[model samples]
Target: MPQTLDAAAVRTWCSLALEALGREREEIDAINVYPVADGDTGTNLYLTVESAAQAVEAVFAAHETGSSVPAPADVVRAMAHGALIGARGNSGTILAQLLRGMAERLGDGDHLAGALHRAATLAREAVAHPVEGTILSVAGAAAQAADAFPQDAVRAAYEGARQALDATPGQLAVLERAGVVDAGGRGLLMVLGALVEAVTGEAPVAPVLAHVRHEIGDPGLEPCAAGGPAFEVIYLLEADDAAVARLRTRLDGLGDSLVVVGGDGLWNVHVHVDDAGAAVEAGVEAGRPYRIRITHFDTTAPPREREQVQRAVVVVVPGEGLAGLCAEAGATTVLARPGEPPASGELVDAIRRAHAREVVLLPNSAELRHTAAAAAEQARTEGVRVALIPTRAAVQGIAALAVHEPDRRFDEDVVAMTAAAGATRYAELAVAERQSWTSAGVCQAGDVLGLIDGDVAVIGADLADTAEAVLDRMLAAGGELVTLVLGEDVPDGDAVADRLERYVRDGYLAVDTLVYRGGRGSTPLLVGVE
Candidate 1:
């Protein structure tokens, strides 16, 4: 058989896997069926790999030795831990589990065949509900191939992964619908291909931030995955319209699942690739994750089980507006969730950052309360001051922020702010993603799903009717004050005021409200209808 695999061999495998993912990253993300909007599978897995890559580089940098074969066990362990901490979405979690499995395999033995078999078995276990046509199935098949034709030959491994990936479409329903194979599986293939190439004496051209470049180093074996980065990566892209479009397209090649959501002048690019260096270079060449807003997902979750720290206050918010509100309220730190709710791990990370010294965590969404509390409990042992005020919306969170005063002893303020938030009314005027039925009415895919306090109060083709139902519900609750914060799509402050005035001016809750819209700030319009 070929020479026993070493640290370099493992590095090559990861690089190949990431490269394969970069190639078909876009297709994989688009093929997802459950949540059509969550087209970030390729991106998620790619980021996880990229984290491992970074760790590997750090490992090697610390020990810049000769061409000596590093211990395979140590390298695999490092890579596994890196993947665990940098994981993002559901796909990212699965990928982390997959690498953890490989680490287990490596831990058990020093040979190549045994490690491959362990990975196959672990891949199978990682999926809670396994499917035939997905990455797990494909990876499993590849493992079997490695076991059978599975020589120490890395080339053979690449060919087998490819074959398995090709057969994925026939197995998975969603893949068939999207007319593509598994995205995650294709990513695995990239890792394998990279490995085969590396160990076979094929030198990579150069590392790219957007692409997975082979680097033989320890990826970090420690299980403790915490820490805010010393430096934040910022992306300042100056591109023409066509150039921006091309940059987005290129980002797909480097890694899929990049979020190109920012202002016209400055676009935000965040991609997790094997070669952070190469990825950054590519972004600079085209556009860049520069002007970096340190992703909460990248940083460690706040320690659960409070620590006996001196003091601290943490607040969870989505946009900059909410963040500012919390800051005004004396929140020591803002646990900002870019444009969505904080993930479970993210919540933990926030608490850890706050050091749990009287931390007050306001989960500004109804659905996110449970997750926030779960994280709070985990951090309870860490001496954290995490108070999970069930703020049902951004408005409520802001209300709580108004009364937050750290210097003042914990008194009626926390309770009052929290009560204000809980007592506050909430509503949304977003378009529907699917044809789902709600209490108000039947909503088609494109119809708007008007909501108030987590209930579908209205569903229609127009914003006016949706606004009426939402406003009416808020009024009926014996509450007169209202705040309507318009989203990105809804602009023209006058439109909301006029509509509310027309609908409820003569009614119980008059049109005495404040309407804010269109700002560099990101907050739900606090349509205060007092």
Candidate 2:
């Protein structure tokens, strides 16, 4: 086991903690009974540590660029700052303070025991109403254990936190009734266990809570679950400690789960209150607050498993109308603007936010192929099963989504979606911005160009004529259904749809057609035949 902690060890600890949390997030969320039962404690902690790990990785990247390594103090500070800024929910906000306190003491020539002791005190101070049988209790116990066995700091801390976690049910009435330990305390114990593994290179034995029971689905026992304030408001505030003190008192009166963490001029504020506006306005009265997030508590519902979300779809589409359509069809959507496409990081974030074990990704633009593939690889690393369908147009994604069946086997579902997307022939009507060369021939600025499968196929002065020509060509290849996506620039509104429908009716009597408004900033019109 490592006798001394350093920057490298801290980085390792962050990674280990994130991995452990990722694996156990759902379990911890299930046992959440204190403060509020929104069933996101595990996700919150994982996200908070994920942010810290990312920040630590950034530091390493910067140091690598400089051909140097960051000092232990600098590494610890970055970890704390990342946690503070990215802290989510009540438990996560308190955890940020715990890490911040440890960073302060650890950087000031303190030993592991002393730093842990300081961490516990600061965590207790951060909470507006410090209660027993929580993470605060577990932290305090770990500190005591560390001081008592300074030579084996990591093991002592883990043992102490584990014992404290086991005893939490007796300390909190809600925990006893729910037949579970404090969820936040359990999460903290996992972090401590990760630290031990970082030092020893051997995973510690997980603590067993044999007394704890699971009555999650029983309605009779469900109503016994704890409840809290209506809305949870969190933000980052830039203010003096004095101003923060007054703000704390005002928030304490507003609601519970009030935690104000951070130091100096920057603070991470969290509170559960009925009046979200009042909580935010209180922050304004204290200082400038930004990155504010508010979540309403669905008090009637029971805590459920988020990490076990069976399947979800994440799609990249252009225009708000397509986004709405995808969302209505139960898919998470990322909007691609006219001149800007979503980066790989955006797609990865959307995949994570989708919160599913299995995800079907639709990159509905040719330029996004590589980016979407990269995102899929990154998400897979985080244990999300991702299938990237190279759909070159929004209409192809629509066709793929039409055939999507979450209940089917994953591989079969992927194959069906892939086949549907590949079989759909897509084209778009766009105005030429200037005299340009095209596959159809040279075109003037006033000309409307019909692009089929990423190549200009026809050009005409009239929108109706151009669209008709493209449709007939697409149908000549054989199609039973025609999808018309009308954009904001379609000058004649329903006239364009009326004309297109009439054209298909007169010539292709066996074919059916459908129309959708593609919203503003989209191409003049999009056509898909399948």
TM-score winner: 2
The global C-alpha lDDT for each of the candidates, from Candidate 1 onward, is: 0.58, 0.86
TM-scores for all predictions: 0.47, 0.64
Q: lDDT per residue, candidate 2, 100-197, as tens digits?
A: 98899877767788888889999999998899999999999999999999888879999999998899989988778778888788889889999898
Deviation in Å, model 1, residue 465 alpha carbon: 4.3
Give the range of the ten consecutive residues with the poorest summed lDDT in model 2: 217-226
lDDT of 1: 0.58
- TM value for model 2: 0.64
- lDDT (10s digit) by residue, model 1, range 1-530: 45355677677666666666656555555544321223556766766676676556556655677755457777887787666645655456556666766677666564555666666676555333456766666567666666676555455555666777777767765555545556566666666666667667663332222212123121311212233222222244555556666666665565433434222344434453334565566667764433333322333432265545544556655555445545655564444433323455456666666663667777776767766787788677665655678877667766667666666666555676677776676776667778877988788987877776667777777666667777776787566656666654455556766777666656863445555442333532333332
> Which residues of candidate 2, in runs, are more than 4 Å off?
1-3, 214-227, 301-530
Residue 350 Cα positional deviation in candidate 2, in Å, after optimal superposition:
5.6
